[model samples]
Target: MIHTLSISELTVSRGERLLFQGLDLRIQAGEAVVLTGANGAGKTSLLRTIAGLLRPDAGEVAFHDGDGNPLDERLARGRETHFLGHQDGLKISRTAREELGFQCDWLGHVQCGMDDAVQAFGLAPLLDLEVRRLSAGQRRRLAMGRLVGSPRALWLLDEPMAPLDARWRAVFADQMRRHLDADGLILAAVHDPLPLPARTLDLGGLT
Candidate 1:
């Protein structure tokens, strides 16, 4: 089922500093919204708020299915969305294979796609290496494997291309486009421009 994310009259702040107020956005299924702003402009904060990771000082974020029916709060927070933050969210002590294995299971027990994801990301060579032993780019690739291994309706990403080389960056660009083509939603905070078609939301003025 396709899902849409709606944010209305949203107000957010960081500590004593105010971020943005009265912000509103609607992301339909198969669409991508890229957050663009200078550092400390609350780009990351907005993504977190949408993901239900932070309490917005004011405003509401809601999830609705294709039929415009509101989803259960639990379902919205669980299998419906995936959030990829600045941190890779991997265990340094574990092998890359183990990390992907755990993520595949957590993302709905779709472990069968792990190998395919590894191959897609060219991660087969790094599988047996401990995560800590991998380079930053390699770790990022491993982290991104979950996006393919386990599908979700919405993806919230922050600087998803930061650590990648030009080649992999282009590779992931294609992947993002494919995700949108499959009726997936993406909201990403990015510095470099995303290769696919996307609406850009600049928080500069909102601040």
Candidate 2:
């Protein structure tokens, strides 16, 4: 009856090869879980599957709402969670403010105000600059800020710490910890240790 994200008997295949099979996971509120594996492992594939962007060859993923009832699948798959993939989804032509505002509107993130989002991400100085002019780390920071500004219960992050330097990495890691403290669930794929304590799911032994 508790709020949780459940994956049962998950089986995912990439073309002719089986990436993973008979996998299972359950994520409760406020928990952070990291998925660790090699390049060809099914970490990303599993994230895509859970995001409803990829279909698993078998098994199912579901989210239970606070009321102990399953959330509407349509809403859960599209809006209840934020999935940050390997590629940054940003418009090179748009300024940081413009881009973040557009994303907030697009995602219907009414609870997160524009000013609060900008300030939270320490992005005031970069607001007027076009995304194309921003450096790699700046762009990544903007993306991280955008995530903090947006409201969602679950976050699916793929290699989130890769673009960050030590300081920003710690900053974002702190943000992740804050998110978990707020009872948000996070599932990420990473090669290194997270700044905060986290439970890890290693895919090395899976056949």
Candidate 3:
């Protein structure tokens, strides 16, 4: 075992359609990997599989601890990883503050405070607003805050920058940069350029 995320010969299909097959990937701490592909190219599906939301048809996905040993599944899913998907993953009735607070608390980092997370996305003003009332981009900013506030080791992000504007995109990039510098790992699916150094894994050819 190694202190890394290793995907070996992964195969995923959708209702009999083979989106991708024989896929292999490896990512380590302090590095970022970006998934690039056209629409319907299985970028989301791959991230979903890595997040444990969807089962892979074949292959193995493993996450090793800092000491390079495989962690138990329960602990791995509980506190070692974070998955931010396409959906807002927020409770509409809850205020931005409450939603983000819950996520940070779930990761056991509530004491870290959400101030930096709020400032990262400029969500300080909208903290008290209900998620339903905020604009789509605003909600996205709040969801992204969970990543910063929680400080999980491995992050699986699907189109993390989708709802952001030009200004926010830069902000998001800086956030990713900081995460990597802190020895965190990132697997992001994106069309726009990532502000930091990222090894690109384009799935366009796999389809």
Candidate 4:
């Protein structure tokens, strides 16, 4: 029953356009919040702000640890929150196996191994292939696999289901449910219906 994220009077602007104003939201552990909006409604911007990747023009984005106290100032945001952007962050030259190995080492945890992720994402055959050589759907699955392996408490996903097929989508949904059950929170921008229970936040209305 901890509050993972808190946003107050958040005002964000990109160039001359104001995405949203006075946006206040709180995400508690174990909750799934779905972001809904039209193409230009700033759904991705909002997610970025929460993940601490983009500072809001006005207002604050705060994070609290499992004990409900604010995290230390020196703590790295990446340790507690995982941001999965639309464009899968991958090194074109690195093979799928190498990328996962690097991430696992960087995170300093081995809860999920490369073999498990490869099987879960159906990337076994493509393990030796370079990321740039893989199809869009395959790359997305690889990105998702990386995110899932991280030990973050909160996840910010933008269009996570975009490149996934029906089978993979189901697998992702199942993984999401498991994450929620373990007291992790998720905020994803998705156009399609979610398989799990989630509260919808319409970014269009804010614009």
Write model 1 residue lDDT over 11-61, tens digit each, in one string.
Answer: 999999999999999999899999998899999999889888999999999
Which of candidates 1 and 2 reaches a greater lDDT? 1
Best by lDDT: 1
Q: How does candidate 2 score on lDDT?
A: 0.84
Candidate numbers sorted by lDDT from highest down: 1, 3, 2, 4
lDDT comparison, 3 vs 4, better candidate: 3
Which candidate leads in TM-score? Answer: 1
Q: Single out the weakest 10-residue window by summed lDDT for candidate 1.
A: 107-116
Report the lDDT tens digits of candidate 3 across residue range 81-168: 8898889789999988899898778776756558768877888899898899998888888988888887788889888888889899
TM-score to native of every candidate shown: 0.96, 0.93, 0.93, 0.92
User: What lDDT score is found at residue 107 in candidate 4?
Assistant: 55
lDDT winner between 2 and 4, please give it.
2
Model 1, global lDDT: 0.90
Tens digit of lDDT per residue, candidate 2, span 1-207? 225899999999999989989898999889999999988798899999999999999998999977778887668867778888887798999999888888777765667466666776678999999999998888877876657777777889999989878888877888888888888899999999887888999876353
Q: Write the per-residue lDDT of candidate 4 for residues 1-207, one digit (tens) a residue.
A: 235788889999889989999998888889999999888799999998776777799998877877878875235365666788988878999998888777755755556555566777788888899998998889999887766666667788999999889999999999899889999889999999789999998888442
Q: Which candidate, 1 or 4, has the higher lDDT?
A: 1
- Compared with the true structure, model 3 gives a TM-score of 0.93
Return the lDDT, model 1, position 90: 97
Worst 10 residues of 2 by lDDT: 107-116
lDDT of 1 at 2: 40
> Candidate 3 at 70: error in angstroms?
1.4
What CA RMSD would you report for each candidate? 1.5, 2.1, 2.0, 2.1
